[model samples]
Target: MLAVHQLYGRQSHAIDSGRAADWAATFTSDGEFRSPSYPEPSTGTAELTAFAERFHAACVESGEALHHVISTVDVAATGPDALTSTAYLQIVGTPRGESSRLLRITTIVDELVRTPGGWRIRRRVVLRDG
Candidate 1:
């Protein structure tokens, strides 16, 4: 459970700090990401990396820093080496010279698997809150 929190912390920091590759590395090689915010799902390492890069580029173009704030995480063990986790995600955007704004709120459900390196996300689904 502690490790899961740490993983989320690292993932959030990586993307927010513009470390695209680092953010993608938190997932498995063939990990999948599905979100209502995006038109299509991103699967595999290459696609995941591209997704992160695009996010960083968008943030750069808009001159805003986007932060993924994850909270109220709920985890359940699915197997000896797998688990499912659900959490609330709040996207906060801070423009270059303005106050931070709440971009959106969503719930993220992640399927994680224990890998030789550590815990990696196998799949993630994001559902935007109305």
Candidate 2:
């Protein structure tokens, strides 16, 4: 559980800091990410890297900083080296020099696997809340 929390913390920091490749490294080699916010699902390492790159580019182009806040994470062990987690995610956005605002609220479901390096996301699904 401690490791899982650290993984998410690192993941959030990497993305919020606009470290595209670093953020992608939180996932497995063939990880999959599905989110309604995106036109298509991102699968595999290359696609994941591209996805993060695009996100960083978009934020830079729009002069906005986006942050991911994960809370209420419920983790369940499915196997000795595998687990699942459900978490509430809040995306807060702040313009270059403006106050921060909540951009979206969503639910994130993730399948995680323990690897030689650490815990990595094998698959993730994000559902936006109305």
Best by lDDT, which number? 1
Please give the lDDT score at residue 30 for candidate 1: 93
Give per-residue lDDT, candidate 1, residue 39: 97
lDDT per residue (tens digit) for residues 1-130 in model 1: 7789999999999988888888898999999999989999999989998999999999999999999998999999999999999999999999999999998999999999999999999999998756
Each model's TM-score, in the order given?
0.97, 0.97
Clashing pairs in 1: none
lDDT of 1: 0.93
Superposed by TM-score, candidate 2 places the C-alpha of residue 113 at a distance from the truth, in angstroms, of 0.6
Tell me how far the alpha carbon of residue 57 in candidate 2 is from the true structure, in angstroms, after superposition: 0.7
Clash pairs detected, candidate 2: none
Q: Write the per-residue lDDT of candidate 2 for residues 1-130, one digit (tens) a residue.
A: 8788888999999888888788889999999999999989999989998999899899999999999998898999999999999998899999999999999999999999999999999999999866
Off by over 4 Å in 2: none
RMSD of each: 0.7, 0.8
How many residue-pair clashes does candidate 2 contain?
Answer: 0
